[model samples]
Target: MRKMARHKDVSPEHLPYRRCVGVVLLNAENLVFVGSRTEGPEHTDSARPWQMPQGGIDDGEEPYPAALRELYEETNVRSVELLAEARDWFTYDLPPELVGHAWKGKYRGQTQKWFALRFTGTDSEIDIHHPAGGAHPPEFKAWRWERLERLPELIVPFKRAVYHRVVQEFAHLVG
Candidate 1:
């Protein structure tokens, strides 16, 4: 069984979940895109600190467009074909330490709508630095292609369960 982080604080229960979108971007070689997040105010204690592209949805934004916008915002890649979407939204709680720090204490965690997208462009089109003309500082400092099944281990422990479910949901579509 998966051991998930237990939130011991009662206050977090009263906080709502942040609505977000997660992208599993696959290249033609069947590898998934994983980014090494930069150390920041919202940084977790994960040793690897790697994750797929993800971000919160704007007000009145639909999930599909939100997913695309996040992917482009984080990866600077716009040439992608929609492959699949998770059957249901998945949620993960912030560790107790992060409950009040991350996302400005706006939510307990995130409720994400996951999408699997196929990269339709060449590697030259991928750029993490200066994403959105550096309008948004890069979330990731470095990135690489990785196996889909390895994501759970590569991500922050608190979010591993969601990553596992996403891999299970989209594994068949990749090599």
Candidate 2:
């Protein structure tokens, strides 16, 4: 049997999964939104550090509202219409190297409720450089619309599984 990794004198398995939300923001072309992460340990993947906008659910916030909040906070996108929610929450574990170093060692991984939203505004409204500013810093250095099926290929390897599931869950909605 494999042994559980320990961090801060505690086993990683003992830590709780953080509750979070992910958004698949699609434009009129049916392409999905992806952002290149501001270089960091988690963003070192060779394929591309790109990922959809995502964030933790604040205490007392519902998943849907949290999804909407996270999208706008990261992308400065507000003209979106709800399309569909994933049939189930998806999750992924941090790779061993990131086990306790990511997210300030607060979570073993994240259990995310994913949302699919259609962009109702033009591409000019998108801005990764100046996302809703306040407490949140810019998470992305650049952004683009990508084919929906290619999302899993562009995300960090540790997060590919969840992105695969999201693609499968929302594939039918794409053109």
Candidate 3:
């Protein structure tokens, strides 16, 4: 098996089957936080190429905690309450090239546990520095709050399905 990255130091099986968590943070303006990948080559034909703050769940960590952790790590935003979590996990496979060399043979892709949160604070709460706790820094140099329904049109194609589910689950928050 290939060794994973420095983010977590646990055996493969102990992890949640490529498990990850993400937060769809909703602000009072009804816009959701969306960010783009800063490091990878841009997709040529993607409809929307941004992604929400998300990351893998560490061994023995619950999905909720992971979701909160990922949100803080990816966006530097914190202190939001977890309002709800998907009853089931939403999964997506990484294109072969997206997988790191260490995870190539042993893992198929990622299985994400998604959550929805309401921002109790202001924009000053977001801290892009050391997002992902230094594991994965901000990919996009910029971020903005946008209508949640419009996200699927702005995210990478591979993530559009999950974005759809997010919108459906949080449709009540849409203006």
- Winner on TM-score between 1 and 2 is 1
Question: Clash totals for all models, in order?
Answer: 0, 0, 10
Q: Spell out the clash pairs found in candidate 2.
A: none
lDDT, residue 162, model 3: 78
Deviation of model 2 at 40, angstroms: 3.6
Error of 3 at 165 (Å): 1.4
Cα error of candidate 1 at position 159, Å: 0.4
Candidate 2 ranges with C-alpha deviation above 4 Å: 1-7, 133-135
The per-residue C-alpha lDDT of model 2 at residue 72 equals: 82
Compared with the true structure, model 3 gives a TM-score of 0.77
Candidates by lDDT, descending order: 1, 2, 3
Error of 1 at 41 (Å): 4.1
lDDT, residue 154, model 2? 88
TM-score of each: 0.92, 0.91, 0.77
Work out how many backbone clashes candidate 1 has.
0
lDDT, candidates in the order shown: 0.88, 0.85, 0.70
In candidate 3, the residue pairs with backbone N, CA or C atoms under 3 Å apart (3 or more residues apart, or in different chains) clash, namely 38-139, 48-154, 48-155, 48-156, 49-154, 49-155, 73-131, 73-132, 74-132, 76-127
Instruction: Give the CA lDDT, 0 to 100, for residue 153 in model 1.
Output: 96
Q: Alpha carbon lDDT of residue 165, candidate 3?
A: 85
Q: How many backbone clashes does candidate 3 have?
A: 10
Stretches of candidate 1 off by over 4 Å are: 1-10
Candidate 3 ranges beyond 4 A from true positions = 1-17, 41-47, 96-105, 130-136
